[model samples]
Target: MNDVLHPSLLLFLGAAVVPLLRGRLQQAWMLLLPAAVIVAVFSLSQGTAGSMTLFGVDLLLMRIDALSLVFAYIFAIITMIGALFALQVKDSTQHVAALAYAGSALGVVFAGDLITLYVFWELMVFSSVWLIWCRRNPTSMAAGFRYLIVHALGGVVLLAGIILNVLDTGSVAFDKISPESAGFYLILIGFMVNAAVPPLHAWLTDAYPEATVTGAIFLSALTTKTAVYTLMRGFPGTELLVGFGVVMALYGVTYAVLANDMRRLLAYHIVSQVGYMVAGVGMGTIMALNGSAAHAFTHILYKALLFMGAGAVIHMTGRSKLTDLGGLYRYMPATLLLYLIGSLSISAFPLTSGFVSKTMVLEAAALDQRALVWLLLSLVSVGTFISTVLKIPWFAFFGRDSGLKPQEVPWNMLLAMGIAAFLCLYIGVAPGWLYSVMPEPVEYNAYTPGHVLWELQLLLFAGVAFFMLLKFVGGERKITLDTDWLYRWLLPRVVTVAHRVLQRLWGGLLSGLMARLRWLVETVNRHHGPQGILARTWPTGSMVLWVAVMLAASLLVYYF
Candidate 1:
């Protein structure tokens, strides 16, 4: 094998063949593929850009630049963590699908051309949908179909944009194309859909929770972050994304506050978290971009850790709703500890990975004097404080005990969560390890006294708010609105109303035409049918006389 076949490709393609084997052998391959990819990507990062051409278009199959490196590195780490968490799953198909899905994301990150990015993008859709359906339940099947439709629309937009971009420029290089053209807007909207930016984000909540416990962990880490990577690479500095990101941030928090399903709540928070990343990219400063990339790295770790903890709980107890779960600390202490770490990290506690990374973006926003954006970020942080850190662990693990006793998770699952947990705390205390891999050289500090004090006050006040309004916050109702409602409800109603108006106008025109036809038929019947001049019995005599005259005229003409 040549080195040109990028190591990420080797892992992805290798995983698809694993299902051909039987039993435990297949499981072994499943675990090994992602781990191998992690090692492969890390090693590949040390080299220069390696280009490959197919279909007469240059594809940057392996770009080792700093921006791509940050995303690719974290993707590999999350893949290993996900694979570890999924080790106990009996289904080889889910394992292969998750690995392929993660591998496809790596391919996109490394891709140097729009065509290459798109190829991997579509592959990502196909590979991840299988994970959603891994549960083999009717609900999952429906959710997967919806998920497919949303992503397929996104794919179409991306492909159309690429084609137009290539046609316009005579090259498909993956540089930031202008967002003025139809193609660029189409591509931006497409990327936003996957990024779960408000309005089109329902698929995350509807589909992710339906995946098998093992599959959801992998699903949570890849697709949205890939969209974030694309936005960073292509649409950074687009002013519209700042507003869009703010909307997603608030939208996610609102729905998450009302969500009952444990995983679904986390999925909503995913949208919220991505909003921060998107806004940072929109800021267009080196610090902001670095913050976005760094956050993506940390988000993948802690988010995957959170999902793994949720998956372990679901795996042991066969439950996922907060109302139906509580006091798991009595039965699964390891999982509780891991879940708390993920929660604290996600909440941006001063000494966790989230704090180290997320603050950079918010700090960047403040320094840039984007007062509105900074305010929105503050509100989102406070909201995160309410919905996730307080809401998730409190309800799922420490709420009223549902009196359910389930065994602790398998050793591999615990080990995976432990790895993620350790990293979260380790990075919280020392962010230098993550800062070093940023696309640009890092000069900012994460733990300044002022920054720490501000975050502490925000989080503490939010916690107080949650307790003061505890009676109003806890409920079983689901918030029924999102950006998806445009297509799901508003668009359909608009179409239906247009159809009704067109139907009425057409019906009136048809009625008038039919009436005229009826009148003409009646007139013809009176004039030319049995009762009309042409159809009456007297017409026979007139016809005979006319025929005689014609014959005479014809005979005279022939003689002449």
Candidate 2:
């Protein structure tokens, strides 16, 4: 065993053997590999490791630092958690895809140069699409293809940016640069696409709900979060993100409020929650960046927990719509309780992971005196509570009884959710544990009297508003049109119309061409066919008589 190793390589190499193993051995290996990466992450010293030269360019494969370590730590933990959650899956392909996806994310986090980052960036896209495809349904298959096409476009944009950046600066280091050039803007666009920033985020909401039960958990955890890590690494302090982030936060909440499907609702919330991190990163203060990282860390746990609860329901009931689910709490009380923990955590209820983490971003906004930013963030928080805590729990678990009698999910799922839920409470109760791992040091307190009172009052009022507007806020069975409608419906219709017009033009051209050919054939037959004048049996005799008469006429004219 080498003393210095890239954590990604361990998982990537380990995934190759997964399909070869069977039964218990396979599960054990899947679990053990992520655990080993965790150990490897902590064992290594903090500096560039696994540096090499490729095409005369220095490629840094492992760049361990506080920032990278935070993402790597959470990624490793989630991989193990995802593995445990997926233990009962009979398909080897899911496990392989999950592990490989995890590895590629690690690769992105640890990559020190643009080239290395781009390589891993693409790998993440390719590997995670499997999670969608593994569902093997028409919806999943189609969503998978759409997911690939969108990310492929993003990837091409990112690659173009890298090439241009390298050409301009003569360096491929994945460090911050001014957004004054085409390369930088393209790169930022690429990162934002992955981050699920609004207008570019419909793929997440569209595809995630269609994934396999366990695969959704993994999908929810990694892709957007990796994009956050990259943004924090490269585009911190970029002011445009502040606006983008705020819109994302509110946009997600607005849509989630209207969503009818359980997983799609949660998927929308993923966008909403990630919005907080994006805003924090854009703020780019010590506390804000820390908040972004901390929020990302906690978001993964709670979001995964939330997905697990929803997935368990789908797994047991074979239904995911809010209209179809109700009275589940009567049968699955434990799941309900665990899921509530996640709900509280996401809503940033006091003494939960979200409270400890999300407040940092708010605090940063306040300290920076960005009053508008702070106000919007506060409102978004209230919306978060309304959707995830009030709407979701009420409709899915306790609302009008569709008479569902789903039993508790498998113990493995329960265990995974338990671990995540516990961490949510643990981090909230003990904020210092999370604060210590932050990339930058901050002494901000989340338990101040003013802070707690403000949070409580806002949540309390939001709760009141929810019940008052309960009828209006209730999930409808109607499909909400999003930006994807432009591509999925509107654009397709436009193309169909154009295609019909072209088809008519082609048909007319062919008809006219055939008509002219027919006329030419008739003329040729009349002039030269065997039955025509020139081709008759007496043609030679008639020609000779005409020639003698013409000669005699010419002689008479010359004599006169």
Candidate 3:
């Protein structure tokens, strides 16, 4: 691959040309761009790291290593899948935006320095938000605005951290930093925001479901996953990530379990899936990092598959609420099967890609003697099973048919989902193909009698518990409040109350001030025809006499 015609650069520049073209040409440009980048990346077997300096700081335009390559490969794969899923959409604006969004993420993965990473980091934010707005609905417009604000805030934090880091260390290398200082902490917090570590996690669930069908699939693949990659690159072994990951895992499961919207449920699971990867990165072992990278790869596949499946259903029926849909399996058997495969993989079921990858993270926790973290991870497995596999498909496709008859999705959409679903099974059945490309060599085995038995037991017993607690766990008509509700609901209510109080206070103050001023004016007017003595103007003669006296004093001083 020529450096001048670097695949990523060519793809990005070519994507910008897509909207100018029409129909088949635009579609070809959109689909081929990611394929070209993937080919170029594969051609370079050994890793390469290089940077360009600007403004006295290094800007890493290209850094090819095993870690980045792993993410880069999946990002490209998901982008291709997304393009296929989006073939039905004739809007060139969306097609180009999706390609640009995908390219920006690939650029970030290859970035060797903080400056280049930041540039693409912000590009990811802006380019992706267009996907949401492409929905062209009021809800999506509002959600996109919120999404922009959240990422804009994250970008600002990231920029501040990078600037402070360059000032403090005189280096812009995007390497791991100790979280013991303010600068490092600032960078960590910025990364955490995108990682959806906590309170900030609301952005994904709030914004993603509002995006257009194909748009949601792309959204599922990039932003948070990029954050995960950055964390793996920049904050591996940070103890705080362990706690952060656990919280996100549990947080995602809880909200997902309570969620009613089909896409929103999957959005919460994104946070949960990333939680596993975050914990793996925090473990910082060869096995754990491999698991993190591999899980992230597979997660993008299955997660996008699930989102595409959901999108297909919504596309036909024009509804996204799970309660509003059911019995779709009868008409769209392919969709049903694909969704099940994705669900099973995401649940870490045996013979699925997730089983092959997620185990390493759990094993890392156990090996590190973090028993509490291990136990929590196990609970998350159960939560994941309940929310995604059992809940999502059961409610969306298997429950009572809502008397809706929609044909199978378009050939291209099904083709994309099929590719992803097949990979889920292929990778699970044969893990070596994926294991070979890991960021680091791993000796741990994914298939073991003990591991299989425990996972089966965990999932089996969780199933039994769900049955036993069916009444408690069943879906409801109510919406569960999340952190976003405070700003979106409670804060506005509080502000409204504050405004009323302030208005009343200001009205009273103005009335009292007006009364006092009126009284003063009346008293002055009564004393001096039109106003007070001081308010009355001096006579012209007095003014002339004062000017003459001043002139005489100046003349006397000059004479003296």
The prediction achieving the highest lDDT against the true structure is 2
Every candidate's lDDT: 0.85, 0.90, 0.85
Give me the runs in candidate 1 sitting further than 4 Å from their true place: 46-50, 179-182, 490-560
User: How many residue pairs clash per model?
Assistant: 3, 0, 0
lDDT score at residue 224, model 2, on the 0-100 scale: 98
Ranking by lDDT: 2, 3, 1
Query: Model 3, stretches more than 4 Å misplaced?
Result: 1-8, 47-50, 468-472, 505-516, 530-560
Q: What TM-score, to 2 decimals, does candidate 1 have?
A: 0.89
Q: Give the per-residue lDDT of model 3 (tens digit) for 1-560.
A: 12433445765787778778887877777677767776766776554545555767656677777899888888878888899889879887788788888888888888888888888899889889999999998989998998898888888998898888877877888888756445797788788888887888888899999999999998999888889999999988887788888888888988888888888889999999899999888888888888899999999999999999889999989988877887888888998899889988998999999999888899888888999989998899899898778776777787768888899999999999999999999999999988988999877787899999999999989888887876566566777777789778998899999999999999999999999999997887877765667668889999999999999999999999
Candidates in order, TM-scores: namely 0.89, 0.94, 0.91
| Model 3 alpha-carbon miss at residue 366, Å | 1.5
Order of candidates by TM-score, top first? 2, 3, 1
Worst 10 residues of 2 by lDDT: 530-539
lDDT of 1 at 105: 90
